[model samples]
Target: MVADTGKTLHADTLKPVNLPEPIAVDEDSAGGPRVVTLGRKLPVAVIDDVWRIDDEWWRARALSRMYYAVILVNGRRLTIFKDLVDGKWYHQTY
Candidate 1:
């Protein structure tokens, strides 16, 4: 038996809070997604495309580019740019 937390829920229904459906991620890490945001428990932007290239080939562990396309709840579009060297993704607002 499950206790009701003042909210009616089915046996199969899970709490929506803190449970975000990850749309996309720049890369996989033991710590989870690098950049994460939720519009309605769903990612407004997901990493649908990825471009990985070994940069500074002469140098060890060079930087790479990772691109992502995100669709916000308000129909707003955004592009996520990430630098693999430092593992950072920036949101591009249009």
Candidate 2:
């Protein structure tokens, strides 16, 4: 669900959205995802939080990702992630 603060709150029950259009990103010197483009460019104003998930490593396929809760230059907050397994970006909403 989207909060009053304009941040989308994500949950596992939320359906995964595979964007038809790829989002363009700007990275920091450290090569971390720092800016993102949806329909328009959104520079990351602040990273409210970050976390990593590494699961199913024991299996032949692994599920790994780095998630970030970020505020954009336009004052929108979103939850985005980089898939560690394939290095793709995704945005989520609930």
Candidate 3:
């Protein structure tokens, strides 16, 4: 079962807490990341949903990401994203 985390998007909730973690991702044949390793090499138990956002594309610091709301093998739900612009992964919490 998915955990019931309340959805509250405050202004301070989206701070740039970029730690720049290096993750090992297993991608599909089409080049889509299917599995990701956070701290324990957890497989994606459930992909609750996914979405993409393309912002500030004209600027140098463009933000393009494919965000996934996935449940890990350890049963922790997390909001992670892949930076389409630079091909990096980040784990975010609010």
Better of 2 and 3 by lDDT: 2
* Model 2 residue pairs with clashes: 1-94
Q: Tens-digit lDDT track for model 3 on 19-81? A: 655567776676555677765567778889889999998998988988888887788887887
After superposing candidate 1, which stretches have Cα over 4 Å from the reference? 1-42, 45-48, 59-61, 92-94
lDDT of 1 by residue, 57-82 (tens): 67776757555565655555656656
Model 3 ranges off by over 4 Å? 1-22
Residue 65 CA displacement from its true place in model 3, Å: 0.4
TM-score of 2: 0.71
By summed lDDT, which 10 consecutive residues of candidate 3 come out lowest?
16-25
Q: Rate residue 25 of model 3 by lDDT.
A: 74
Alpha-carbon runs more than 4 Å astray in model 2 = 1-22
The count of backbone overlaps in candidate 3 is: 0
Candidate lDDT (C-alpha), each: 0.52, 0.79, 0.78
Tens-digit lDDT string for candidate 2 (1-94): 7658866768964775654234567778975667899887778999899899999999998989888788998999888888888888878665
Candidate 1 whole-model C-alpha lDDT, 0 to 1: 0.52
